[model samples]
Target: GAGVSQSPSNKVTEKGKDVELRCDPISGHTALYWYRQRLGQGLEFLIYFQGNSAPDKSGLPSDRFSAERTGESVSTLTIQRTQQEDSAVYLCASSLSPVQPQHFGDGTRLSIL
Candidate 1:
């Protein structure tokens, strides 16, 4: 893709339901990241995948949230048993390297009812 791509720009789910968000990174980007922006809050890093190494999941809020990246091309974020507190804008970004500026997709706005 020319830039980062995310699926289903908006989502609305009942509390306790599960949701999945997808991301497609740029063609040559080696670093992919997932972040969440709660209403009135700043972006919070959720996970990071770099190349073929182990993914960094330290920032994930809980076991309910998980993400996977295949090589460096595409990624998915799954939030299981969602809660009303989980409503937020989930953003995806990709960069060529750790030191480079990341390019972001519009994001999937998750709304838990």
Candidate 2:
């Protein structure tokens, strides 16, 4: 697809388990972002990556959440010791630059048991 892509449309894991979500942004995009959307809530920004380096990660809810990108292509969001509250839809987005309009992916639904 020409738009951002996310893997494992649905993921089910037990509480305290670790999970990894993947994202592939549109080619040539230099800015990538990760967001989490819980039931009835808006998208909560998680991290932002310009190229391969993350410049803003203040939106991460806890230390258990971390994300990294490789070059301007794929990125991965890892959650360690996942908890019940961590269940949500993980969304990925990308733009030509930080100031450009973002294109989003079909989010990954995470269900913690």
Candidate with maximal TM-score: 1
Q: Over 4 Å off in model 2, which ranges?
A: none
Clashing pairs in 2: none
lDDT of 1 by residue, 1-113 (tens): 38788999999999999899999998899999999999999999999999998999999999999998888788999999999999999999999998999999999999999
Clash number by candidate, in order = 0, 0
Candidate 2 least-lDDT 10 residues:
46-55
CA lDDT of every candidate = 0.94, 0.94
Model 1 gets an lDDT of: 0.94
Report RMSD (Å) for each prediction in the order shown: 1.0, 1.0
Error of 1 at 82 (Å): 0.5
Off by over 4 Å in 1: none
